[model samples]
Target: MKVVIAIDSFKGSVTSLEGSAAIAAGIRSVYPDAEIISLPVADGGEGTVEALVTASGGRFVSLEVTGPLGQPVAAAYGLLGDGRTAVIEVAAVCGLPLVPEAARNPLHTTTFGVGEMIAGAMRQGVRDFIIGLGGSSTNDAGTGMLQALGYRFLDKDGQDVGRGGAALLDIHSIDAAGALTGLQACRFRIACDVDNPLYGPEGAASIFAPQKGADEEAVRLLDRGLRQWATAAADLTGSDIASVPGAGAAGGLGAAFVGLLGGTLESGIGVALEMIELDRHLEGAQLVITGEGKLDGQTSRGKVPYGVAQLARKRDIPVIALAGSVDHGAEALNDHGITAYFPIVNGPMSLEDAMDPAGTRYRLQATASQLLRLLRAAGRL
Candidate 1:
């Protein structure tokens, strides 16, 4: 029997590789001579770069770039084994975690560092990009990132506007004469999980700015600013992206790429899986195992387990999902092709105790052994 393990990182507990290894050990205990392929997986969010880099035998390139608050911060991206494809998580440069809770104001943050990262990668001869647009700390309608790429956001005085989302209120026109020429030769694929509009009740400011430290009043102000930016951007690019799904993701970074850069926004997990060639690895696999830190209704929405199970279903392979805990909506996972799911926690224990790496490994192995034994008795193995 051949088994393929493609599990995601257990947040705060283990990396994707670590989780996969623990589960692989479990499967090995049951099927000593079975061929096993362990693949680390992610859904283009927190652990995307590291997971892809590790799975593809790629190298990471780190550099100092401007942070959300205009301070220098270190960031990293991955150069996959293909040598030309670079995976960059936009959050690494200007994510919410980089700023303290007291300083998490979206009005003043910028995605300039993300543009700088892309430019740096371009200089290194990278022609393709996989940009993960989650966990951003900015709401500038991607103006800061555009500025870094040589697109000038001008005010009425023909002078450049300041950085941050608030400055978008003064944006009058865009001077793209100096826009980066390298962009014409590059292809960008943005990974996005949300489908909010650019500016409205369910748009960027209304839906996400609060979490980024905006008050009720600030949300109104930011919404107006986004409206002004969208107007100017549409006038310049001839694209009305304000109502586009996912345009409000990452504080309107999605709109900027779609409207200005002609980038394609797609499912985060699907993009990551395609990059790692998960389909190629699943060929002839008898069983597939995938999971994450939590399994719930949310997991059915472009998450790693859902994505992996979708792939396995196409090949008529059974998928078993493993997680640290299971929530109310976990039963819904069955509709997404998960044959069954198991929570690794053995018994009543504190969250801290269940997350211990050693204990997690032990439980995963024991669970896998028992699962296989049951399958064997049912003549399904």
Candidate 2:
């Protein structure tokens, strides 16, 4: 019997790798020699670095960089075993978690830390890169990151615009003279999943600005800044990135990567699957297991489990999911090659108790055991 445990992180409580390990324990209890393969996954959001490392034979390089609120923070980027490809998650530097609740505003956040992460990797002989743009705390339209990389944004006085989206509106022109020269010699891929443009009603400000603590009026100010910055980026790079697809991802960090860094935006799950060699793992497997923190209507979108399940279908492998909570639309998961879906909770428990650190592992183990038993009978293993 062959079973593969492929699950994303439980989020806030456990890691995807750790969750797979716990699930492996239960599978072992059922079939001591079940030939189980553990493949931890992430959707290019949090825990993406570890996911790439576990998925591919990737190495880590750490450095000191600016955090969300302009504070110094230690961050790391990854290099796959191929030795040439770099995997960088911007959240490692300028994510919402680093900024305190009272200080989480788009007006002041910057992607300079993200730029520093890339710059640090470029020094290590790394060339090709897969940048994961998610969970950002800024709405700077890529100006901060471009400034860090040598595309100088100057105010009317011809002086540097310091940092943040507020400064973008003061720019009269941009100078790409001092940016990282090596970027011109390498291939860059940005992993993002949004289609919002850089400005306007459904653009970066109106859609994502509020999440970064921008009030109604603040969102308007941020939107105004993006329009000016977008024009400047076009003049500097000669690329129309403002209205581009996914330009609004990570508060316009995706646009920065595409416009300033000369990178192309790609799907995060597509990148993860290729690096992990999931197609290779799916061959001849009797069953595949995948899940995330939750399964609902959104699961039909580009979530990790859904993408993995799609791959499983091509190989005629049945998929089973174990989620933190299963919603009404979960039954639809079966249409995507998932033979069955199940929730991890045992009966009804308080949302807090279900999320307790002590209870998560036990519940996951029990859930996996029950799932294995059902698969055993139906799978004829």
Candidate 3:
């Protein structure tokens, strides 16, 4: 049996890679001779670089950089096996994890560390960049990153604007000529999964800012600042990036990547698939196992599982998903090439108990056994 296992991270419990491994173990139990190709995937959110690196045989490069709150911290990005392409997760440098809950306000966070990571890689003579935009703590318009790279966000006094989203209000003009020299040889691809615009009711600040500890008032201020920043960026780069789809990702860092780094925005799942050449490998595969932490209406909106389902659909492969939880109904997944959905839970349990993690490996293995049993009865195993 040439079975392909591709699953997203289980979040808070197991990584996608770990989940795939457990599933593979169970598959082996059911059919020891089955040739299973396990590929743990991330949807351009957290853990993306590591997943791609593992699948592509890439190496990791660790570095120290400023965190969301200006404290120095150590973080790492990935180098594809070729050592030419760099995979960066902005969250590694400026994510919510790096900051305490008390300091979680978006107005205070910054993406400067992300730029520092890029600059560090560039100094090492690596240029290709794949930026993952998810799980962010900042609502800045990526102005912090621009400043780190060479764009001077100077105020009227010629002093540099301070860090955080509030600084965007002081952004008069962009002096990108000298700032981004390090990335001159770099090509950029930004992995984003949202379609929100840069500024407005459905934009970055209004939709995402509150999640990062922004109060209602803070969201309003951030929204105005983003609009102004967008206007300035357009005047400088001739791209109305603020209104662009997915530009609101990661607190408008998506806009910075596109406008300044000239990065192409794509679904996180699509980026990983292209990076790993998954489509080419999927040829003639009879079945595809794909999943994520939770499945629901959101899955219909271009999540990783949906991306995998799309590929399986094109190949007419039967696709089944195993997730930690199933939200809403399984009917929605059917349209995306998923034959059925399987939740890892076997009994009623608290959210904490389900995410115990210590017991996750066993739970996953047991679940997979059931999956095969059901499939076998259907004469498809």
TM-score of each: 0.98, 0.96, 0.96
Q: Candidate 1: give its CA RMSD in angstroms.
A: 1.1
Which number leads on lDDT? Answer: 1
Q: What Cα-based lDDT does every candidate model obtain?
A: 0.91, 0.83, 0.86
Rank by lDDT (best first): 1, 3, 2
Clashing pairs in 3: 9-16, 149-179, 150-179
Tens digits of per-residue lDDT, candidate 2, 294-374, equal 999888777888889989999888888888998978777788878788888887888888887568787777788877887
The alpha-carbon deviation from the true structure for residue 350 of candidate 3, after best TM-score superposition, in angstroms, is 2.5
Residue-level lDDT tens digits of model 1 in 1-381: 999999888998888888888778877788889899988888989899988888789999999999999999999999998899999998899999999999988989999999899899999999899999989899999999999999999998999999998898898888888988889888889999999999999999999999999999889989999999999888997889898999999999999998998899999999889878899999999899999999988999889999999999999999999999999998998998999999988799998898898888778778888888888789998
Model 2 sits at a Cα RMSD from the real structure of: 1.4
Residue 81 lDDT in candidate 2: 83
Worst 10 residues of 1 by lDDT: 21-30
lDDT of 2 at 362: 78
CA RMSD, predictions in order:
1.1, 1.4, 1.5
Which residue pairs of candidate 1 clash? none
Clashes of 2: 2
- Comparing candidate 2 with candidate 3, which one achieves the higher TM-score? 2
